[model samples]
Target: MTVVGIGYVGLSAALLLSQYNKVYALDISPEKIYKLNKKISPLKDT
Candidate 1:
């Protein structure tokens, strides 16, 4: 699946859906994209 806008919801969905199929996440922020590519969560956990 090709998912555009890898923000909170998109990233969550991509992570969930990826278990059963291929997932591609896209975002406008290059920094966020780079962070995600490195397996880093852009959002901070409480």
Candidate 2:
């Protein structure tokens, strides 16, 4: 599955779906992509 955007909803959906399927996340920000590629979460936990 290809997920466009890595915002809250997109990231959440991708993470959930990834458990059972292959997921590819996309975003406009290269920084965000880089972070994700490095196994980092762009969203901070409160």
Candidate 3:
């Protein structure tokens, strides 16, 4: 599954869906993609 835009909603959906499926997250921001690839959260959260 390909999830475009890794915003709050998109990221959440991707994370949830990923548990049972192969998820590929897409974003226009290279930094965000890079962070995700490195196992880092792209967004700030508590």
Kindly state the number of residue pairs that clash in model 1. 0
1-46 per-residue lDDT for model 3 (tens digits): 9999999999999999999999999999999999999999999978
Instruction: Report the poorest 10 consecutive residues by lDDT, candidate 1.
Output: 37-46
Candidate 2 or 3, higher TM-score?
A: 3
lDDT of 2 by residue, 1-46 (tens): 9999999999999999999999999899999899999999999878
Task: Give residue 36's error in model 3 in angstroms.
Answer: 0.3
Best candidate (score: lDDT): 3
Model 3 scores worst on lDDT over the 10 consecutive residues at: 37-46
Comparing 2 with 3 on lDDT, the higher-scoring candidate is 3
lDDT of 1 at 2: 89
Q: For candidate 3, what is the TM-score?
A: 0.93
- Compared with the true structure, what per-residue lDDT tens digits does model 1 show for residues 1-46? 9899887798899999999999988888999889988988987777
Best by TM-score: 3
Candidates in descending lDDT order: 3, 2, 1
Each model's Cα RMSD: 1.1, 1.0, 1.2
